[model samples]
Target: MIETSTSICEVIAKLRIAREAPYYGREYAFGELWNALDRLDDREADDESR
Candidate 1:
């Protein structure tokens, strides 16, 4: 897994490029990537709540 103390999207992009990956899961990698992005957002929201 790609670890970043910074941007997750940037890290994910790098991972995608590194693997030359187009689609990741059942649909496409973009969908998986978007879900990852959403996780980041959810984390931020959780942080704000705390």
Candidate 2:
């Protein structure tokens, strides 16, 4: 799960910097993606604790 979240984060970071990125036009998409990754990371940490 951590790997999945990390990979997603990496891709998001790339999209944030890409020339044709639509994040500037559709900022909510970026926000949603980031929040999703954060949730995934939090869920993974919670599972590890349990």
Candidate 3:
């Protein structure tokens, strides 16, 4: 799993770039990736609530 916010952002950035390529996840099969991104957003929200 993504360990740090920097790492998470890096991976999401790469994944999004890859996603734009043709024939990549045509049906968007990797739900965990999406979940991780959501988790990152949730984490940010939690941090901001402090």
Candidate 4:
């Protein structure tokens, strides 16, 4: 699980770089990643509240 999470973070970092460069084609994937991360944050907050 730790390894998987680490890999996911690495992928996100690369997507962020790609998004910034603007020469790497469409930025759709980066936007999706941001939305997914926001959902993850919300879930974590809910779990903590419980």
Best by TM-score: 1
Ranking under TM-score, best-scoring first? 1, 4, 2, 3
- In model 3, which residue pairs have backbone atoms overlapping below 3 Å? none
Query: In terms of lDDT, which candidate is strongest?
Result: 2
> In model 3, what lDDT does residue 4 have?
52
| RMSD each, Å | 5.5, 4.2, 4.5, 4.3
Cα lDDT tens digits, model 3, 1-50, are 33456758755775775567556653463454566677777777777787
lDDT of 1 by residue, 1-50 (tens): 22323448654775575466644543565565666677777767776787
The clash tally of candidate 2 reads 0
List the global CA lDDT of all models.
0.60, 0.65, 0.63, 0.64
- Candidate 3 RMSD to the real structure: 4.5
Worst 10 residues of 2 by lDDT: 14-23
Cα RMSD of predicted structure 1: 5.5
Give the count of colliding residue pairs in each prediction.
Answer: 2, 0, 0, 0
Query: Which residue ranges in model 2 land beyond 4 Å of their true spot?
Result: 1-24
Tens digits of lDDT, candidate 4, 1-50 = 45446656866876776577655554766766676677567666666787
Model 1, which residues run further than 4 Å from truth? Answer: 1-19, 22-27
Q: What TM-score goes with each of the models?
A: 0.53, 0.50, 0.47, 0.51
Model 2 has an lDDT value of: 0.65
Q: Which model, 2 or 4, shows the larger TM-score?
A: 4
Better of 1 and 2 by TM-score: 1
The list of candidate 4 runs beyond 4 A from truth reads 1-25
